[model samples]
Target: MTRILPLLLLILTALAAAQTVEQEQQPIPAEPEIAEASAEEVLDIPPGDISPLAGVDLTAPGDITVMDHPDDSGDRLIVSFSPGSEAEYADLFAAYIIYRRPAGGSDEEWTNVGVMPVGEGTQFVDGYDPDFPVNIGESYEYRVSALYLDETEVMGEPVIAQEVASGQWFHQGKVRVLVACLIFLGLIFYFFSRARMGATMYLRPIAGIEAIDEAIGRATEMGKPILYVPGLSDISDVATIASLTILGRVARKVAEYQTSLIVPNRDPIVYTVAEEAVKQAYLEAGRPDSYDPNSVFFLTQSQFAFVAGVNGIMMREKPATNFYLGMFWAESLILAETGSLSGAIQIAGTDAVTQLPFFITTCDYTLIGEELYAASAYLSREPMQMGSIKGLDSCKAILMVFITAGALMSIMDLLAGTQTLSWLKNIVTTQIVD
Candidate 1:
């Protein structure tokens, strides 16, 4: 077997050598020379017919229609044309260039407005050009030309629009937005009416709000003052307003429990509002004389300085219960840590997302996000407040359902390649300009 293998190898080596020799002996072919032609020869046009319109289709685009653009702010005109001569001379047609002039204007006034590459789209909007926007309520005439690739064009007859561009009273595209808004308003009214009739609208319990009474009671038992910080924001802030509303409720409870209350402020305006709210709460609780004018006082306008002052109060007074509510900033941790170290049962609430982590870690119960805003309504449970909260929640639930459905459809369309739910996706993503 070894001897036969050597014989086969020798035959294969001889065959490879012979093929290499034959390939080396063959001659390589030369590349053909290409002669450059003149412009006339390349274009297939006679030298004498060297005009700009040479050998180009002179048939104009037909069925030119011009009108005021719909659903716009009265500054646009739409011009469209049919492929009459375009179909016959489709090979030479490169683009459709449009021109416009004032109505009844002469040929000298024809201005080159825009150029559209053929087959892209058959429509042109005149006022889309920022440099030469059409004036509203002005009449204009349009002319379209079929441009050929040979730097030549055939101009079409002019067409005048019957109606001048004008703004409409309502935008047609925002109908969906209008309908959604109307539905929300109707929900608000329905819930409002039901609430007025003493209907029991259920709301999920908030941990921070439920713990308020417990905290107040603990402070009363320990005979320690309750510290309430209405945040460090000004009076105009929504969080500050919500804090004030909550302050009224908290102060009334404090008044009823006959416990000492301390509210330190950074803004003088907030201090004024807080004082009034506390006094009114005392009046409401039938302990008007128990409301101390010095309880809700302005400490300082500086940020860190106010924190230092509040921390001092926490250390000295050793308040049994601490309430940190409103729009807190960088000072949130400083205040909450101080209260925690003082061994106070702390409850914090704020819409400030960045400060939530510190409060959650330090306080006993923390009202998260919208809970701070909903605190007043939850505590008061007034008919109007309950109704509005219920209506808002219902709208949110509906939106969540829509979002979930859209997400599912999007996933299905992506995986299965059906795209059957594209209409729903478009509706979900549509921008309504009102």
Candidate 2:
């Protein structure tokens, strides 16, 4: 036993030594991306002589730990952080903390939690409500930043905090919404998996999506650029994600048709990710050489500014095909109307029930609410995504029947509704169980 123990100890020692050597040999990661200073220093906020932080080191944002707030009592998450910026350890005397959403969400707007005073460490707390009463499955996140704004403008590593499940409420009909959302996302992953295994998905007739090839071809024929607006929102929203997914498909057809594709984005991070998606699409089409980094451009963060920029691009380039895929706001009409005037064939798809009418009037092809979510089913011919769509359809059908039956029973004062409805309603509403 002693002999075997010695041999085991030797093996453990060797593994530890090997790991240590590998870690030391591995180069330290370049600079960490700080939400305050930015990975690209796009903010250009010069470091000031704000004063040295006492005891804490704010040189890099990563030196601090933020709470995960995993408890699921369905409450708002407020995380407080202290700066660890040390004068000797940090580059700048002046310190400030800033943050942004990693995926460029509207809620990700940088908010200054607090300013660091010289000789004192900086501290800040975030109060974020994940709409606990409305969205049970939704996740809320943000990156906390520590800024060392000296003359050189060095940044601390950004600390990210994710709220754990907080017993959020589901959609109005919990079971139905749960099943449908599951089937939708499940299909996306499943179909992509099947595609990886060389299985083809049977994509159905999606009018708007089907016209992508025609639009790209028309743009090529017209010698004008193709405009791809992947929605103004960040990636958190399902609609925005659907738009981005469609963008990959649209970009592929555009690449194959050799048409100029111009993507203008309102969010900086969206611009970055969209660029990657476009580049990948082009690569998939074996036309990586045609992929232009500048094709995916950043407009302004302002809504109108983004509109004006995209409008100008559309009017000037006169793209024969404009693909509007994303969640939109009041700017929807302006873009759609302008594209209509430009004689561009607009293929618009959004989950906004309010704007569906405008798309119908101005767009040649338009996708309705769930249809936007059904895009993977439309584009990829993978059986799983198709099956998911079928599953969701089945779920929605069940929901409609249940809802109808319940309504009819309530109206007719059926026995079930008469005797049990009131009690169940009262119990659920008042959190009482008698």
Q: CA lDDT, every prediction?
A: 0.89, 0.69
Candidate with the greatest TM-score versus the true structure: 1
Candidate 2 displacement at residue 301 in angstroms:
0.7
lDDT of 2 by residue, 175-251 (tens): 54456568667755764565567664454587776777777888888888888898888878878888888888888
Supply candidate 1's per-residue lDDT for 326: 96
Model 1 residue 299 lDDT?
99
Number of colliding residue pairs in model 2: 21
Q: What TM-score does candidate 2 reach?
A: 0.54
- List model 1 lDDT by residue over 130-199, tens digit each: 9778889998888888877665677888988777888888878888888879989999899999999999
Instruction: For residue 408, give model 1's deviation from the true position in Å.
Output: 0.8
Off by over 4 Å in 1: 1-180, 427-434
